[model samples]
Target: MSDASVFIAGPASWNQIVLLDRLPDPVPHMQFAEESWETLGGTSAGKALSLRGLGRTLLLYAAAGDDDAGRQVRAALETADVPVHWARSAETERHLNLMTRRGARVSLYLSSPAAQSDRDDAALQAAMKASEVIVLDLAAEPQRLLPLATATGRSIWVDVHDYDGTAEFHRPFLAAADVVFCNADRLDDPLAFLHGCIAAGASLAVCTLGAEGAVAVDAHGVEHRVAAVPVEVVDANGAGDAFFAGVLDARLAGHPVPESLAAGAWAASAVLRSRHLHPLLDPHLG
Candidate 1:
């Protein structure tokens, strides 16, 4: 047991990223690309990696395949000194992400993940019980931990990712989180959605608006706003996760909500300036 303070649970994907001028239309027989790369990507991985980079003790509980991709995922985390307890499945979650210069992305799943039986595992249960913070992502496997998370009285962070506020799968997660992070891509009124989160039980609610900035409502119903930090965006894949990690780290350090939001903006800009999920996460490990 590493006694890590933060616990993250969800999918960890092995992705092939192809940089193109733009995403191809629905019509077939189209091809255009500038470059490509392979990397580890998923909401859980992104958040965990960024938090670790911010100098936090991170413990990740996730599932991956027994294949080479899974090996890569495990090695990357281990090399970064982040302890991970991974359930070995038949195949890892794999994706082919087609991205553009403007950060537009179309991800195609190459292989679907197999069902994993780690929710009831002893090691994962121990980690869950010991961690100071539990971050649950939108995945079927992690839903079982919601009840356990509720029992902890520790902070529970959940990212609803571009929810339209009506998905049945997201309701349990929304209710389980002490803090909720979301993006404004799908909702016409993000502020209303954030307010709804607070009403639903979360003490804090944050909404990230791509290039514009981010806004948050604290437990006292005070709205905090911060503009996005300017950076030359290389890839938009992990910016949201970076933002979430930053705000979480700041809050954990007892920073004010406005200062925490500013920290988030700063972290997100660092991701935008680099091509990887966390710029130093990969090469530093290598």
Candidate 2:
């Protein structure tokens, strides 16, 4: 863990991805999937994979159950060479994601992992204190460990996904985060929200805009934007996570915000061109 520069804590799951021409309408109707497969899921896993692809040294801390699905998830990460410290949970997290070719998705969570013990906390806390940055994805465990994370005083990065800007659950994460990322999916005004985040003391706030690209606001209140790299879309499962990883990696290397955004756009293309969370998972997809 001493070699790891980034420490990530969140959910890691085995997931089934079903692709269709478009997101299924909210109705009871049968539809055939254009393609379907099982692979890794969970925002934290995605970030870990992407960061590994970027040649970054990182340690991932996540909960996994003593179940077959949990074994699959753990094996997959080990195969990808993503170092992880696992916590015992009652069950592994699982999700059924129905996605469109153009990237729209509706995720159905099959199971939520429940921590079985607090034995992993001592090690996780040590890793956090040693890391340069601590990334806490949206999960109950990380949320519960917010105080410890804040105490470390390292840079904290968070991905809120499609935050609507009023959820009580997200406030603590937003408050603890130095850098924040989200998509424009549910927000009525993404730019305004970014501004609000800056006003609230975040060093930076970014909103990804699917194909149009991404936008950001720095601590100085200057806005930055980047055009998405055009690519033959395969799956959008982990693009946002990839983008988050890229930006963090670049920033840590002393790149400016605009350059970091470009790095993020490029990183996302790797996932956009793959069927799995990251290209490193391709050989282990089966």
Candidate 3:
């Protein structure tokens, strides 16, 4: 796998995650005790950092404002020895995530700095072509990379988090990915959607079932299931992305889907025990 490198294209944001006892109701004048901190968040940021913790050869490409938050992101990834290809913007994006200790979350997307889609950049083009795997998330900048990644003949992995199936913006990403992942929280019938992804030309499709675990369908149309590894939940902030990174790392190492799913489960368990993005990856990961 020497020639195989991963390229992640999407959004990276500075997030203030507030952990509460429980998600508050929509009533007037209610308060809950909360613990909060700033961390890196965003589909692209989470996946990229998680992948780095797994010791993959990766280049992360994403848009962020030229601000302190963006600097923090670069410093964190650099300290981990992961290279970044930052797309510049006027301001950085920010998210206010209200999470429950039980792992429930209500994310408020507070800011998005304007970014120009720089698909024509020479370095970006070279990275995409050299990558063995390309991970795309549902951000405008990343979406613009779909066609380019497809042209590279690299394995395209796209995470359509909370896709309800009928979202117009999700269809193109769905059609472009060779491997697909989603969560069961938004879909009325997640299993059906997973099946639909395979039918729509994906070689494999997966749906994370939260506490219920995860499921996948391979290219042969054989379905596989893996239960979540049980662990005392500390913070569930980046668990799903950790799961994806683990599976991706395993798959790149030539593990079968079932084994990869188990690896994903193990990786997710470690993330559940951490307070931030993927601080507890297994030593065996490298």
Model 2 residue runs over 4 Å out of place are 115-117
lDDT of 2 at 156: 93
The model with the greater lDDT, 1 or 3, is 1
Worst 10 residues of 3 by lDDT: 277-286
Query: What lDDT score goes with residue 59 in model 3?
Result: 82
Tell me the spans in candidate 3 whose CA falls farther than 4 Å from its real position: 1-4, 115-120, 280-286
Best by lDDT: 2
lDDT of 2 by residue, 12-67 (tens): 99999999988878899999899999999999999999999999999998988899
User: Which pairs of residues clash in candidate 3, taking residues 3 or more apart in a chain or in different chains?
Assistant: none
lDDT of 3 at 85: 75
> What TM-score do all the candidates reach, one by one?
0.94, 0.98, 0.93
Best by TM-score: 2
Model 1, 117: alpha-carbon shift in Å? 2.7
Structural RMSD, model 2:
1.1
- Candidate 2 global lDDT: 0.92
Give the range where candidate 2 is weakest over 10 consecutive residues by summed lDDT: 114-123
Give the higher-lDDT candidate: 2 or 3.
2
